[model samples]
Target: MSEIQEEAVLEQDQIIVESGRPKMLGYVFGFFAVTLLGYFLVNRYYMPAPAVNTAPAVRFAPSELLNDLNKRLAYLQNRTTGVSFYIHTIRKKENLWKLASKRHYSVHAIIGCNPQFETYDVSIGQKIIIPSRAGTLHPVQKNDSWQKIASRYKTTLPELVKYNNTALDIGYGDLVFVPDRRPDMALMNDKLREKYELRALFVSPLGGRLSSTFGRRKHPVTGQYKLHGGIDIAVKTGTWVGAAADGVVTLASDGVGHYGKAVFVDHQDGYVTHYGHLSKILVRPGQKVKARQLIARSGSTGRSTGPHLHFTIKKNDVSKDPLKFIW
Candidate 1:
């Protein structure tokens, strides 16, 4: 009876051990499968995807890029019309003076447009806005005619009208945009040449014959060889002395050495004229005179032998031959 019981118990124990090992193996496999499934779900649905590069690899040179940008900007500027504004970026070695001169604008005009610039001092890379054209704003006054206004501003009537987009008759207190109206060198030279060609038709400064020429000659009073800087015209005493050209009187006094009662007229076009040996000065400094206008009376004064008018012409402060211009 004891041997049969022992053998049965040993077989039952071995069977139980084998069955428990199989269950443990199943549980381990199930746990591994669950973890793998969880990782795949999270990666596919919840986690962010890896970044992908999409930009091109090519690069551009700085100069080429700048040139391209400038070309585009120029094209845009040219296409703009009417009253427009310009944004200027200050460059190296640039200042208000250089900018105004290059653009043919006055420093005041540049300052007017850019009031934000507290001072004339400007720095590179600073941005400023200005008008494309150069000019100033003028207020119309009573009794102001287009011709008078144009003449005052040194511009043509047509240009004034066009720029202001106004009628020929402007009202009092109306504002007008007056552009720089002075003619260029070429046009001025042409006008001067034409005027000299018709000198006979134009009024002469004095109705007298040429007494002395401009050059090196023996001085009449000094009795020495010296340079005669001007032409001498012998006219009767008290003869009316007329202006040779339209200009402003810059000097009208007797203090000028060797030229008593001298009168200097500035044509405002780089040309100036001097009339000396006058007895009476009819104009004052800053007085505007017209061509053929009365300026003084002739007399023998300031190292002169007789009553005569010594006339001199200057261009850009350099003395030039009066004969070449007197005709």
Candidate 2:
């Protein structure tokens, strides 16, 4: 009985050992298969390809290139010939004199670029074009030639024509830039120069509320729409009025025309200052007076609404805005 039991135990142990060998071999084979598959997938999809070199195709246009080169050459030639411009934005505390001095250009040079500047005074936040050199812009008149303009500015014809880069033909009102020519203040247009000089030479003779502005308005007494030639400064009766600038008294009388008791002073440069609506006249005709000198007293005289001084500035006998010359 003992020998048969030992033989059965040995047989069972052998069967168990033989079955475990196949399962172990299968697990090893599965792990190796998974590792090889992952390596193959990574190598196939995750690797970067090497870069290739290629030449780009070129396209050229002879006509376009020639035109562009010509433009660039013209621009360069103008720059070399002292013709270039830049714009300057006026900031707080910036003035024409200061800007001119800083930029090494004359004040007249800056004025030539901007025709709006009747005087050297410039306002804040104003944009002004500034030339690279000192010069002015002259408006072409009828029958104006490049040689004529050059002679006027004292420059050569070629230099004068070089200022204008766009076209060769010039017509009336075409502004021709004159480089390096500082304009004579006295030689400027009689009206324009007079207005510019009067701004600095004259002062407000009397300070008061502006009762009337110089423009087209309904006349208070006449009740008709007409151009008011002077600005009225509201003041009390017998308020002292003064001469605007040093000039010869042209007229001083009482009750003449619309200006009741008025005094007119001739500034001798196509400029005349008139003080009207006066209670009394202090200066007689042909008398010389200084600026701020008492000439008359304001009053509510002929065709007046109230006691005020009617002041006007005339250029070539044509009445202009008095406020432009005075306050």
Tens-digit per-residue lDDT, 1-327, candidate 2: 598999999997787678798876886799999999987765543322222213221222323312343332333244223466666789998988778878787677887756545566678987776767788767566897766777777766556534554333456655567877765455455656876665686889898888899899998898999999989899999989989989999999897788888889999679898888899999899999999999888997777888999999989999988877773
C-alpha-based local distance difference test score of model 2: 0.73
TM-score of each: 0.40, 0.43
Residue pairs in candidate 1 whose N, alpha carbon or C atoms collide under 3 angstroms: none
Pairs of colliding residues, candidate 2: none
Per-residue lDDT for 48 in model 1? Answer: 30
Give the top-scoring candidate (lDDT): 2
Lowest lDDT sum, 10 consecutive residues, model 1, at: 50-59
Output the TM-score of candidate 1: 0.40
Superposed model 2: Cα runs more than 4 Å off: 1-196
TM-score computed on alpha carbons, candidate 2: 0.43
